[model samples]
Every structure is written in C-alpha cells, then in structure tokens.
Target: MTYQDKVILITGASSGIGKELALLLAAEKARIILSARNEAHLLEVQAQCLSLTPHCHVLPMDITDERQVQEGAASAIAIYGRIDVLINNAGVTQRSKLIDTSPAAIRKLMEVNFFGPMMLTTALLPQFKAQQQGQIVVISSMAGLFGYPWRSGYNAAKHALQGYFETLQTEQPIPGLSTTIICPGRIHTDITYSAITGDGSAYGAMDPGQAHGIPVDVCARKIVKAMRNKKKLVLIARMEKVLLWMKRYFPPLFYFIARKGN
Candidate 1:
C-alpha cells in the first residue's frame, strides 16, 4: 500500500532503525509522529523529516512510564485524528550473562523491551478499533527465536515480545488491524552502546557483531516492505538465519556454534 498521507507513529524515532524509517517514510509523503525519551534527539529527527515532508511531529515519551504511554497514545491520535500504523521500535539490550545479571537489570529490560510496547499497543487499541483498521509493527530480535551468549535479559525480553504479539495476531482483537513481527539479526547500529550490564549500568561499548552486521538503512527498507505486504513474520539476517535452522534441525551443533558466537 502507498504510504502517501498515511499517519505512522514510530517509537524510538530519534536514531538507528527508527530514525531511518522516519526519513524513508517521510520521503514517501507519510505523516510521521516520532516518539522517544530524548526530546532533543526527537526534535533533530523531526527537523530532518520536515525537510523531506511537511507532516512531521515530535512526541517526547518514556515508554516505560505507564502514564506517559497513555498520554502519548492519546496525543498521537489527536495529531492526525487517527493512526494508520504504530511501530514499536523502542527497546534496550542486555550485555550480561544470566549468572551475573541482577534481577533488577532483567526487570529493567522487560519493562522497556516487552511491557512498554504492550502498554503502548493496549493504549492505542481503542483508536485502532475506532478507525476499523491499523498496522502494528514490532521490531524484535534474532535472540527472540533462540538463545545466545551474554544476553540473558535481552533474550528473555525479545522472546516475550514474540509471544505477546504472536498471540495478538491469533486473537485478532481488532477486525481490520494487522500485526507484523520483525526479527532482525545484528543490524549495524549503536544499540550495544546502551546495553545494560550485570549491575544495570550501561555497557557503553560497540559490539563487534553489530558493527559488521547489516546496515541500518537496509534493515529499515526490509521492515517497510514487510509492513506494506502485511506480512505475519519477517526475518532480516544473514548467518543468523542459518543458526536458526541449525537450532531447529540440529540442536547439538546449534549449541556448539551459538556458544562460539560473539
């Protein structure tokens, strides 16, 4: 479907895949609403989108905050009277193993990566129902499909996202609403820099795997294509695709290779 004049709300639109999506969608002449905790960065992204299209608004929000999420959902609907799409792209990663990671750290990851998206989606459900049509895109991770080293909380959170959204798809609470779950492997972004450690502190380092992975723009393009197709599920990866196959067909070899992965 054409994006021209479509109202799309994207969370975490300040940078990475979200920023690229905003720019790309803006170029398509879609009305864009950007949301994230960093108002300054949101404004920067808004300015960039404004250069491409006339319809761009910034809604600063911390998804983890239930009150803010409720307000943000209402404000987003008010901006364009109705939202055609909601991209749940805001999330955090974990850099600590299960043995060393604190319970609080795991909870923090859950709050942002799982509960936040669920809350926002729930808040916007009525709006989608009122419109009688909407699209929900969730940016999960390869970790959701399988476990990996040094990412216990991240894995759990993404897995939770998979379960929740997949169930939503099956339930079909909104008749004309559709859900797209995207599993991306090691996209070249600075997500690792904000990764939480065992003590819930930022890892503050770029991951070698992420640095060598698919480009952020490429990832965004694939996501948009999947959304337009109304795809049920999409996997954007290289070797991780093989790893998933191995996990399904040969568990032992998958474990051995996954252990050696970075």
Candidate 2:
C-alpha cells in the first residue's frame, strides 16, 4: 500500500539495510523516524531522507542500552502520538564458534540482537494496545532458520528473536497488532566486518558471500513489498531459501554441507 502518511520508526537507520529502507519509505512520503547510535551518521541519513520528504526525524540512541530504548520509545510515541510501524532492524552479528566464544561476547550480541529490540517492542506495546492497530517488522536472518559454523552466538540471538516475535503474533491479546519476521540471507554490508569475535572484538573482515550478496536497495524494496503485503514470515534470497528447504527437509545432507561452509 501507499506509505504516504504512514509513521514508520526504524532502528539502525544510519546505515546498511536500514538506511536503504529509510530512503525507500521516505520516497513514498512516509513519516520516517530514523534511530541509531551514531548521531553524525543519523544526521547524514536524516538529511538524505529529508531530501525526499519533510516528515523525517532523527532519534539517535543505541538499542543495546535499555534506558536509551525506553527514552527512544517515549520520544517516538510523543511524535504524533502514534507509531503505525516499528521495524526492529538494529542487530549485531557474531563470528565466533561456541568453543571459541566468550560468555561476555555472547551476552553482548544478545543484548544488541535480541534483548534490545525486545525491550523497545515491550515498551511500545502499550501504545500499540491503546491505539488498537500496529505492525512490527523484524529484520532477522537465514541463520535464524538454521545454525552455521563460526556463528553460534549470532544464530542463537536470531533464533531467539524468531521465537519471541512468532509467539507475539500467535498469542497477543489484542486483535489488531501483527508481527512480520523478515529473514534476509545476505546483502552487501559491513555486518561481517563489524561482527563480534571470540574476544569481544570486531572481526573486521568481510565474508565472500556477503561481498557477493544482493544490493542493499534491492533488498530494501523486497522488504517494503513484504511489509505492504502484511506477510507473517518472509525468506528473501534465492540460494538461502533453497538451503533452508534442504535444512528442513533433508537435514542429513544440509548438515554435511554446512560443515563445509565458510
């Protein structure tokens, strides 16, 4: 549908998929609220979005910070007193295996990828319940559907997000709220380089698959299309969906191949 007047709040809007999505929505004249930790980058994105529409606002805050999440939610709701859509796009990846991963590193990824988004979603639930209608879109990953080597923590966090949002979709007491989980396999981004390592440091190296992944704008268009359709779950990327089918229907073969993946 047309996002001409829709109030869409997006996390991690400073860069990557979130930034591209913001540009797409802004071109549609949506009232965009861009949230991220980097104030400078957020302002840069805000300027770009404003070139498309005058309804863009910048809300800089780290999703990993609970207090900031609370403040961000309050600030968002205070804008026009409604949030038609909240896109949980803020997340961090991990490049460490379970054996190599530190407990602290795992927790850090969880805080950013799973717990932070949940805190923001929980804080905004009341506003949604009061309004009687809202859409929550989660930008998850293919890893959420199946485990992979050297990404145990990232897999765990995305898996947790899938469970949490899926439960909300099925069990929410309200009648008008709907949750959509979007699983994106890969798109050219800095996520791989920024992923946390075993020692809680950035991996700082891009993966071959990510380097050759789909364009961010193409991924953003697909996401907005799915959002318009109000889909419950969407698996984007051709190769990734095929792999998911194998993982679900041919576990033995999938496992054998996954062991060889990089």
* Residue 163 Cα positional deviation in candidate 1, in Å, after optimal superposition: 0.5
The sequence of per-residue lDDT tens digits that candidate 2 reaches over residues 143-218 is 8999988888899999999999999988976789888899998788888888999999998999888899988888
Top lDDT hit: 1
Among the numbered candidates, top TM-score falls to 1
**In candidate 2, which residue pairs clash?**
none
Tens-place lDDT per residue, model 1, 129-195, is 9988999999999999999999999899999999999999999998999999999999999999999
Q: Clash pairs of candidate 1?
A: none
lDDT for each candidate structure: 0.95, 0.91
The per-residue C-alpha lDDT of model 1 at residue 89 equals 98
In model 2, where is the ten-residue run with the lowest total lDDT?
A: 235-244
lDDT of 2: 0.91
